[model samples]
Target: MIPQNIVKQNILDAIAVIHKEGVPKERESTKYHLWYNGGLYPPKYVISVANRFANGHALSRDRFNGGAETNNFLKRLGFEVIEETLATKNEMQMSEEQTFRVGEYYSRNDIYQKLNVPKAKQKGHWNTGYTQYEKDSFIFANVGTAGRTGHDHPNRFDGNDLIWYGRNKSTLTQSSIQSLINPEGRTYIFAREDSNDPKFLFLGNGRAKDYFDESPVKIIWSFDNETENHPEILAEEVNELEIYTEGSVKKVSVNVYERNPIARKKCIEHYGLGCQVCGFNFVNIYGIIGENFIHVHHLKPLHEISEKYEIDPVEDLRPICPNCHAMLHKRKPAYSIEELKRIIKDKVTDTPH
Candidate 1:
């Protein structure tokens, strides 16, 4: 929201902020401009960005309009408002299609209304709809809360893995649970470390390691550092659709991922259904239910590939157990299979039998 009067210095500061953070892709203008020192800036967007200096934070686009109201306000401040060509708009670099950035914080309303991500209807383990940038969905969790039924499930970390419990009476076969194993899509975490925090931290992406039975489905989620960064361009405010307070929470979720399935199938065909690092065969342990169960790991991770790459099943893929797969990706760049195997070997050799 724009104030009655804003000094000229705030407009200069907003221009500087735009250069540093780049403009939000959707908010960039194609025709209108507010001329300043020979540079053309988007009319309403300038005020939206200028809010940091004028109102202490940026406001969402819906809170104000550009046409006559915003342009006239800036004119009253003695600034030149001019019509510009679409070609002039290309001068600024646009923040690419990215989502809730890792390490940054966001409230529920930012996800639903602002970003247009579908609301996660479930209280704890939620099913949020698809995100626009990628075909995969964006899911979130408000951690550190026990259920209303008096069950204590804080979703604690065991070693590097986190054991997350689904909503009350949830089963291993629920769509949310199935998302972990679904090869077509992967899950990104928007989790608040402390339930009372107003916003959630984008805590990397997660895949399924293992899961157990119902009432509240128990899943061992293995997280990877693979995450996208939403440009730090917007104003930070306490806009919320669902709030997580002490002893109670309103929560949401969505399932999504991106991968090469044909390559994965070929890798399984070559490697067989067993863990390459530890030789843990799913069928050998769990019989029929575990049949064909294994996580196909890319020797070359997706984030590392900048251009289109033809995946080689023999050269770039491997069959790994969920536990070992999690360990492989624990660090940046991920550990090589030989390196992880040696780690297991060294630990076993050091153990007293």
Candidate 2:
């Protein structure tokens, strides 16, 4: 039997190793196998890392074969267990179970690679969102720093925006833009730090509404708050909530939003296909091809509201394009549609064109 203190120390030490090396892949150097709570399993048809605890000294090839005990332990810990098949050369295959299961906890790039979503047609870029629908509706994002690699200095929430970064130097093509702004997509964010035991803390989910080029090379995908209440998720001070063991797992919860699809639909229906602030309509300009396309923005920011409140489709929601929606959220309290329209008018009049 392992002492509680020894188990705690080993778990912390293992997390430190994973923080540096990431979850171990099959047949890669096994030095980082310390991160797996149970004795590490051999490379098999599917690779998995369970959160089952064991004595650090006994993690060897012989004791590594996982069984009923390990499965039971994982169930009790509430860890979302996943087993993914190796992606073969020339063809990638993944079951639907893998897709829905992944978004519960993985980052964008991580889910793309794990679920074997169809790759980008061009080299040097990858399709981060899926064309296929899942039983569950969600995507995962790592908020903090440029690449989830440091302090919370550049949090998207701080900028009053939900941001997704693109591959550096990759040309932003029309296809890339569609993959990001497709109205069907929704995202679940995770609070990740440079050093954390589990590495991901569940935040909440929302819809991807717009995209912009921060630079010629950098693409920013912006999302709107649909039904997410993210105050607790965003308020967490880095490393303050310890998830060192199963008992401490209450720090994270499986938060799923009760999104008002009816309200979203009605807002677009009433406002037509044009952005309320900028007056940009996908359909009128792009012909029949862009019909029925507009993002619905919630007037009140979810973080500010703590209790359940009824949504008024006309008063609480507005149909806006991605650009207008992103601008509306640029300030802390967020600019009203009238204010944003006024700002746009000023910019347009000031320009020589």
Question: How well does each candidate superpose onto the true structure, as a TM-score?
Answer: 0.36, 0.28
Residue 317's C-alpha lDDT in candidate 2? 80
* Candidate 2 minimal-lDDT segment of 10 residues: 88-97
Q: Candidate 2 lDDT (Cα, whole model)?
A: 0.42
Residue range 1-353, candidate 2, lDDT tens digits:
11223333344444455545554454343211111321232221112221233432434434434444333333343322223223211111121222332113344455556556555622122222223233233322333333423323233332223455544333356444344445345544444433233334334444444455553223343323323322222223233324444345434221122123334444655765568887786533542223344666778767756665556668778877867866877787889999988887898899996
Best by lDDT: 1
Instruction: Report residue 31 deviation for candidate 1 (angstroms).
Output: 26
Clash count for each candidate, listed in order shown: 11, 0
Q: How well does candidate 1 score on lDDT at residue 121?
A: 43
